[model samples]
Target chain A: MTRLGRSAGRRPSSGFGDAPEVVVEHAGFFSHLVTRSTGRALRMEIEARLARARGAAVAVLDLTHVVMIDYACADEIVAKIVERTGQGGARRVLALLRGVSEHTREPIQRALARRGLAACAEGTGGRGMLLGEIRDRENRAWEEVTRLGRAGTARTTEAVARRLGTGDRQATEALETLTARGLIFGDGSHYVSVAVMARADTSTASADDE
Target chain B: MSRVLSVSPELDHQAFEALVAELPDATRSGVSILFDASAVTWVSPYGLIGLLALGREVEQRTGKRPMLEPPRNREVSGYMERMEFWPAAQNVFQLPGKQARRHGDSGALIEITSIRSNEDVHAVVKKVGEGARRILQGRLGYSKASVIHFSIMLSEVCQNIVEHAGSLGWACAQTYRWQRRLGREVAVLAVMDVGIGFEQSLGARNASTGSAAALEAAVLRGESRFKDRGRGHGLQAIRRQVLEWHGSLRIRSGAAMVGDIAEWERRLAAGAGGEYAPDRVSVKTGLPPFPGAQVMIVLPAAEESITPGPEAA
Candidate 1:
């Protein structure tokens, strides 16, 4: 059984034909997760209802309450929508994200852009919030890697481990793999600044064929 | 005067040592060695770095850097780029020819055009790997790891072609050298094909995602255009390897281009460092236009090896 609920306000719409439309309010990380799981359920329910109603069906993900968003949840929601609508072609999936801040809205916008899905965050009604602090951690790691180069190897590994909340061995292994491939070079001592290695060489012998 | 030195598998090391020994006593005031990589079938970072170290030594002694000829093998070039030694080498040597032109200098070029199926992918990769090992043994007098990661990258790319490139098509790889500059050498490797463009094969994910997204996804390590259950880490792995190793990765798909690591770096340097931006180019497919993907990997000269820190050793 799916828990379907609606925000306060608005009279019962007639077109949906008794398939309860769930309205999502308050977008945070947890809210986003609930919305995604709920969205999946709603999509199935709407499809079933449409089959019974003998009419066209649609799923509207109203992010009017979403205050923030991050990459993982944004990817999950957008990917699900794109997959269902693009592949299934059974229901019209519309995203009504509103009232989100620019900073919070960017990742979703980017994902949408990549999928060729048109969406905009407008005013206070459209804001979506990112949960779990994943984006915050990723940005910090990128910044650290870009600043310290190989000298920051340990720190970068530690930061990534902390961000992913995974074991340190995995992170260290990743770093070692990169080093063996000649992507990041260091003597395994003090960290060299990223400025030197960051200006990597782009031209060589590989550009001949196409 | 440029010279071509061919040695048997057994004499490879002896030949390299002889060359290095001869360097110190050469009558020429400034000696710049230009490796005729066209004839050399394979190479690796360890082998390459050994030769590069010798070149560095020569430069230190005579104030002239030895030059490395571009690799005639695309697989070898890919590996070089991943090591990030290609561009740094460019600072010391002349640039190789652009696109598909044949080498004009007096060196040999090994053309690898025998790739046809998934099985062939393995064979060619192994052949290239062995060839690189042989080259290192003959030219640099050193042997490091036998396993080359580029072989893995090549296998994945070739597998993609075998499984998807639509019908039967062939692949070619070549390497060569330019000239010595500022006491260093520049080498290059170029790979081309006549198959379905990346967009046609990967763009099927979502008609809306288009070819560009497919290309971007291909280079993103974990993203795969295929719905198959296997790890779709081929191109993504290649991209990360290239970036970390100090090389460049360039991809072309029928009028749409994505995955230019150099351009990415420039954007990063310019402080426009969010996600990658798309740039459109006019491309032609083979059915009517020239359709297919051309991947060029450029690597600079290898940096001098730093003495391992006490903590690392």
Candidate 2:
């Protein structure tokens, strides 16, 4: 079970409900991330913060303020974190990139693609998009979930299966795959997008192994 | 008696080989060498850094500072001084008289700077980034994105010296007007070191593979001496960006050189019957054995600013 503990009595103004999301704002910390050593330093700081949070927490890496990021920094920070997050350690931290720009996205994409890993990023209009490798079925399922969010759907397996016009088993497999990759979170029978998790009220937010 | 070697009139990438070829074998000990640059009329960034490396090599081997006869041409000497060459050279060359004071409009985009650690690389980027907007954007017509790429490229090249060379090195950049030939401005960047080169750094098995094969493996195939996943991407990315910009890049280590020669350079080479026509394998090899690596990058002006010169007719 995933329980949120760091609720600082502050509610998110984005109206998606205040989930106890750990936001690691990097723009204020670094002007640019260009070298391997600098990347390693930032990665360690992010890892330390993730380790402090309770089980199965979603961490938003806000890159809006960073000026530039080179390949070394991208590989050292983003790729390493994605690789480690997928390892399913005692404390699982899912990463969601926020405020990625055209200049910074290329290196991040290349870094993740090289390792055959993928991470969810906040796209335009607060929707979620995959940044690295993804299969067609997985992508379709993710798109369906985000599409349902347009109408305030709960993103349950049965709802996704009805939308994809596929049977419940295939849809369940797709959602489960996304959840395993940390692109989405599974709560018993329903899946929640990271976009929602970033704002969901932690008092009611609970993710289960299913 | 000290050995005397005359410097080439036009010091460049190709001339560096001729310079090194004049050195005595590594086994010759305790014989101080004198570099007579009294006749050198012009020098490229490669030539400048290569001289430092050569001086360091001689000093380390002979345990005595190499004696350098300053260039006789006042213009050449002035150019060197303004580029901050004398300050760096003081560490490697022994002058006969008082060191000349440097005061002038330095034509260099980035002055000769030593690369000993990562902080040096950061300083280079910061120093160059300040003036790169005016030079790369205003003169060369490079877009903002291109300027950023150039900074990253510069950072990676300097990092190679820190990460791979295992010794000290120097880096410099200057803008040159190819008025007679290309009628365009090109930014020339050179980075050189006196340390373990590709053949030794790659591993024991590659020790005998020679510099050409090792350069080909590293630059073209992106093979690194390290087995890490992200290792060796710098050179490959540099090659791609240089090609996309229609520029020229050459790397020389040990006794061989490998390069992506631009079309204009190839034409000039063919016209002059130069050894670097890219037609023969031996052309890239058979240079005098030298330690460490020397890299040269020439980025031409963007297409909008390019125009054929009188020589083109």
Candidate 3:
């Protein structure tokens, strides 16, 4: 269910109704030696505009034009943009990432990983992956789902729920999210990450049988 | 009688300019030189290479063979012995220095070693990037972005030594203060190989026929020895980077030599005095050619710079 949280009394912080989307055009070979000051300026613009617009917005950082991104510059630009723009928490702007190539995605992923933040990342070529945190409560759910890999288990929602002590609904959400991010595959009734699937093949054919 | 050119203990790139500065007039004066290495402290790979250039300059101008007075000190001479410096100098001047085995990396100019494979190229690139980064950032004032480009440039040049030369090669880099030309600091990266020459390599790929056309096409047009897509941008990228930094590129292989003297090569076709120099200028020389390709790239101090922040280092 897509429920819209009301922001009548104050500015909507996060995971809410239609927010303003800002496009940040990336330029050049985006290098560690080349930190874009404009990224910081864009975050400030969001902060200042949100204070005036008096509501929440989602800032989609468009890096389609950026040729290359090294690790250090990626951290300098993206992490600060995410943390300073009120996307660090709720009641401010949220940061979403789009137009990442395999070349650019690595450094961006490393930067987000270092900050313990997550943003929706997608390349212009249609591959999307999740990194850092998801705004919803199912943010850390994938850890338990991937942990099932060590036991060499191919699990259904019920099995994962039983193993992780989460409700069936939570397990289903976790499995669905993991599948969407291409981290796991769903074979009709069972969910299996690659290692778990490999182990399942040797241990029991039950995954295929079911 | 040959004039004696005293060799400093430190015959590094830092001293190369001042050493080379008097050479043009000295060689023009048409005197064979006696390169005295008696009181030398150390000689980097680039320094040895510089010594080779000095020999070539003297021979190319006066046709008189210069001789070397090897360092009297046992340690300095041994260092040269380990570097195979004498033989390398002998290659240019036809002097008397023993030909020994080219040894491993000695931390002088990204190591004085032969590149055998892609792994060697990567190792050299990593070492050059790490060791030279401080010089580029602090001294030459290139942004980190430019430094990455330089890394790619170095890798491409070194990789060429393996892929195209078809023979073992040597690569080295050093930062020097250019008091004469630009009067600022510059970083010079030189890669040389004693293998099948450019004309042969390009001809083998069915790209061009002769040494002149092949040398011109390979360096100027960035044409590769393979007819594959997404390949052969090393020299071209280096050329563009040199343009951006207002640097220079000089390349000599086989019987054909092309030099762009706008720091040595420039962005536009213009070489020096606003005269249009083609991407490559083939000079026919009678001097016996080196067995492989030899390229020297000079990146001048950046015209524009930012005050590096505390975290910049």
> In lDDT terms, which candidate is top?
2
Most DockQ-accurate candidate: 2
Error of 3 at A147 (Å): 31
- The CA-based lDDT of model 2 is what? 0.73
lDDT per residue (tens digit) for residues B98-189 in model 2: 77767865757788999999889878877777578888888888888776778778877888888789999999999888775577788999
Candidate 2: which docking quality band?
acceptable
Of the true interface contacts, the fraction found in model 2 is: 0.08
Q: Work out the TM-score per prediction.
A: 0.34, 0.84, 0.45
> TM-score for chain A of every candidate model?
0.33, 0.75, 0.47
Query: Which tens-of-lDDT digit does each residue in A160-208 have in candidate 2?
Result: 7876789889888888788778777554434566665555453344332
Number of backbone collisions per candidate, in order? Answer: 74, 5, 14
* Model 1: per-residue Cα lDDT over A46-131, one tens digit each: 44443442221223344444433333335445434433332222122223333444434544554454443433223454222221
> Where is model 3 more than 4 Å wrong at Cα?
A1-210, B1-47, B50-111, B263-288, B304-313
Interface C-alpha RMSD per candidate, 1 decimal:
16.1, 1.5, 12.5
- The residue-by-residue lDDT of candidate 1 on B178-261, one tens digit each, is 122112232233343445666677665646354556566565434655563222544554565455444456665554455434
lDDT of 1 at A137: 39
Each candidate's DockQ score against the native complex? Answer: 0.01, 0.36, 0.02
